[model samples]
Target chain A: MMTLLFILFATSMWLGWHGKRKPAIFVFLVTIALCAFWFKHHATSELHIDL
Target chain B: MTPTFARKLNVIFLIMICIPLIGAYTIQFGRGEFPCPLCLLQRLAMLGIACGAMMNVRYGIRASHYGMCMISAVLGACISTRQILLHIVPEPGNTGYGSAVMGMHLYTWALLIFIATILILGVVFLFDSQFESKEATSKTRSVPALGAVAFWLAFGITVANVCTTFLECGFKQCPENPTSYLML
Candidate 1:
């Protein structure tokens, strides 16, 4: 899962470097969404530190 | 705040962002401690922040590009804040997730950096002169030598992270407290 995030970032950079700015931004957004999804679990996990 | 100088500053800014990532690597390899899932996510946000500055350097500087950075910093702060909170209440002998550096956990430091990114971007945004001349698009403009070098440096780190993360997490979810590279 973590690998996927960086892969998206690489794709975005490649796209941006090649002059595909719009798609690069889109790919970046996707990676951010994926990161957030993974983070949601960690955030909501029952931590011993309540709230 | 001409676009030319802004590009140079962005290059320097990109290099600055990579420093923490390198620091994380040193801690990972030097201290033999692996980053947890949350720690990995903070790196993602940092790289995302770098990506915005990278866009500014590669293409002509644009407000949208800076917007990209501010959004990333905001999300990163959320992740870092949550991680800090998770450990703040503390449990017996738990101490925290990873080893401390300079008396503060990495996540705490991450939150600080995210806030700094947002603040820096906010101030940079004030220099409206940098956003002039939208006609100077990526095709018309060539990045300066330093800009290209910094761009590659940040991109290289992201690519390197891709390889390291694959080895660490494999196709499976990362372990809560990673001790060794999973694929290795």
Candidate 2:
């Protein structure tokens, strides 16, 4: 899950750097969605601690 | 560099400012070293400055310089005042707030950098001076922007790596049997 977040973050950052603002924004939103999903699922289940 | 090029440079400057701040978090969380009050204060100031710089890049040079200076001033004053107090008192009982209340290492290098940042922002704010005004026209601004961006990019990536390390380590405590240093 963390890895996925990192990948998404990297993708968004790359998109932003490459001057694709719309895609970058989309990627950023996707990253946030992934993070939320991860938090709701694996974060608590794996870490056993509320983040 | 061209004016458009300079605007891009401003973005880089913002990235540079993010580096150390991220490093400090890494040092604290990754290394299990807790941040003292002054350290936290400095971090807060740096965060504000970084955000301001990012905003400036998102907007323009004039906006970035002014916004950064304003935010830096607030954080700088808080950290600087704390440092001055630490230097004067240098007693655990004299400290205020969290670990600061217990007193911790002064981290003079960090303080120095904070001071330097304040000074740099001051100069940036004064960019309206005759010399700076001449430089602000289309062509000259690009060089500074480019330099600023390069600096920020290097700084940001370095610090972000540190932050990543901290997230991995996931520790919340300062070192046991910690050493306390006098501020002076």
Candidate 3:
């Protein structure tokens, strides 16, 4: 999961540096979506823990 | 907006980020309260954005804008990650010290506000292109250098505090239960 996040983050950083606004935004949005999905899945399962 | 107006807006943004941080600290030290994992993440994110905004205001928009956006994006990711972590892994072993607030209801509100602020900043950065203006860009490079220094200083102090708190009370000594409500 961390690796996926790092990849997304690195992609966004690359897009930003290259002045590719749309791609950067897309990457950020994708990161947010993945995070939300994982969070929901974790929250519903028995292993889910709230801090 | 004129350069002057942009500068003012940058300052305003910085203050927006700082006020809550100071309030959070007061609540933590003065009120003897501790923040949870999500809360700590939010504080860290806010600090990053505040530093970026402060530098933009002090220098110029062109130099600091990309850096600010990057910082905002990083912060947004951190806060979002913390929230997900809390919801998915609520066990004692997964928790960190000073990650849970001991008393008062306002901390939750603060957390929500902090998260929203980071997200908004990230979105703003996504659409902003003013920083790329050739004339303004050259004048703004120095801003980020100074901002980076300040960011490290603030981050250093925050880490030191967290370290001290962790040493004083291991994770086992802190609250095991999660907050009953979700701020988001």
RMSD per prediction, one decimal? 1.5, 11.6, 10.0
Model 3, which residues run further than 4 Å from truth?
A: A1-51, B63-107, B118-135, B139-184
lDDT of 1 by residue, B1-184 (tens): 8878998898999999999999999999898889888899999999998888888888888888888888889988998888887788777987888888999999898999999999898899889888955667645258788888887888899999999999999999988878889899
lDDT agreement with native, every candidate:
0.87, 0.46, 0.49
Candidate 2 per-residue lDDT over residues B130-151, each given as its tens digit? 1224234223122355544644
The Cα error of candidate 1 at residue B184, in Å, is 1.3
- Model 1, stretches more than 4 Å misplaced? A47-51, B138-140
- Name the candidate that leads on lDDT: 1
Instruction: Name the candidate, 1 or 3, with the larger TM-score value.
Output: 1
Give residue A23's lDDT in candidate 3 (0 to 100): 61
Give the runs in model 2 whose Cα sits over 4 Å from its true position. A1-51, B5-9, B87-107, B126-184
- Give the Å error, residue B166, model 2: 14
DockQ, each predicted model: 0.67, 0.04, 0.07
